[model samples]
Target chain A: MSTFYFIAFLSIFFSILVISAKNPVHSILYLILTFFTFTIHYILLNAQFLAIVNFIVYMGAILVLFLYTLMLINLNKESEPVKPFMVKIAGVFGGGILAVALASSLKLVAASNPVILKNPDLGLVKNLGKVLFNEFLLPFEVSSVLLLSAMVGAVLLATKDPKTA
Target chain B: MESLTNTIHAVPLNHYILLSAIIFSIGVVGVLIRRNAIVIFMSVELMLNAVNLLLTAFSVYRGDASGQVFVFFIMALAAAEVAVGLAIIVMIYRNTNSIDINVLNRLKW
Candidate 1:
């Protein structure tokens, strides 16, 4: 096994831990680790700009939000209620089928005439900036609008009182 | 072309597929087993990340910058999702004082 495989395996393992852990805080911590591993993967792919952005946005900002949300709830319930045995069995069966289907399809896709890129640049921050401002400018601006809407909607939902008003 | 060829050869396709598979499974298990809405949101993020990984891999293989562009969009959408999702979760918590999604049925008419 190569170093890439090792790192990839580690990333997946930690991510699974993130989901499986009962404690929400622990899950968030594991998610942070998962994000870091993804940053490493991005670096390996030579997407240095993306790696830094991943670190800053996901590990830095998003994970913090996740943690804060968990804290705010203050359930004082130590452990989340375990899912029933029947649900667990169904989950395993469904997940297994999905994985098998995806794996076989991916194998076929990978084997069929592998695409090879030509003249691939480093795609540094500068290059990405240029492309964002030039070719992808419209979509980028639209995304800003989307974010604005989400923010406003969130505030409205959180503030509304069904009982009093 | 030369640089792309080297990059493609550097990372094998199986690596991407395996990562995607594992991450997707995590998301599935999360949605099935976890009752907390916030954690379920995180699980969905996991699934989106898996798809992003595959997208970037294909972009690299095909030597087109578009896939990365899509990843950028996905990230933006994810941030928006979290902002709105957390707010909704807060509302749900406020209403019932519980984040357990299974309990959500009582809120519905």
Candidate 2:
């Protein structure tokens, strides 16, 4: 339980750092840390397969792509024009209202004490794989198709004609 | 394993829900406050992750594998989103020499 609190605190802290950092590169690094903490949260929830997948997909692949783009573009503090002070205040106020609304709604949820199983292995790779393949075969195939289309779309959007440029 | 589960269950599920809500709100603020397109994109990812954490928590409480399966789909979607979205951002940068989304408001026609 203490471990959960500690990691949760770290995740929140890093998430703040992600948004607050002036440097986009530092924001990306903090985002990586946030993802790492999320991976730990997955493990704590007994979702080991997801923990590993989150590490690889988020930390290794997606975040690295973000870093690469940021580096390629070379955006610095000077390049990022600051938002007006009024806009900043409004943003914070809006976010605060959202948090309050969500937290309050959560309080209304009737807590159902679930039967905790001893040695629940649902998060194991073997178990998750079986479920995913058996029950989720269609979605699995669909996701592959989605990935293919996304790849094609990205290539199309990024490619430029020499004559046009 | 049992001890770990026990420890996890010791913390009430509401705590997790609250934590997720807080993080989600932070992500929202990031999106609203930041001017950088990449930073906004990162905030959107943070929001997705917050939902993922909530889903995983509910899955644990309900002893359901479906939620985890959904998380799998979300991750895939996120990967695809980042890929295509970044490509578009790069394209925009190529055209405008800047990644600020505000500068792209010339489509007022």
- Best candidate per TM-score, number? 2
Off by more than 4 A, model 1: A110-120, A160-165, B1-8, B107-109
Clashes of 1: 2
True contacts kept of each: 0.48, 0.69
Question: How close is every model to the real structure, measured as TM-score?
Answer: 0.89, 0.96
lDDT of 1 at A160: 66
Instruction: Give candidate 2's whole-model lDDT.
Output: 0.90
Off by over 4 Å in 2: A112-119
Model 2, B3-64: lDDT tens digits are 66776867788888888999999999999999899999999999999999999888888888
User: Local error of candidate 1 at A114, Å?
Assistant: 8.0
Chain A (alone) TM-scores for all candidate structures: 0.87, 0.93
Give a tens-digit lDDT track for model 2, residues A1-165: 899999999999999999999889999999999999999899888899999999999999999999998888866635678899999999999999999998899778898464353349988888889989999999999999999999999999888858788
* Pairs clashing within candidate 2: none
Error of 1 at B35 (Å): 1.0
lDDT of candidate 2 at residue B30, scale 0 to 100: 99
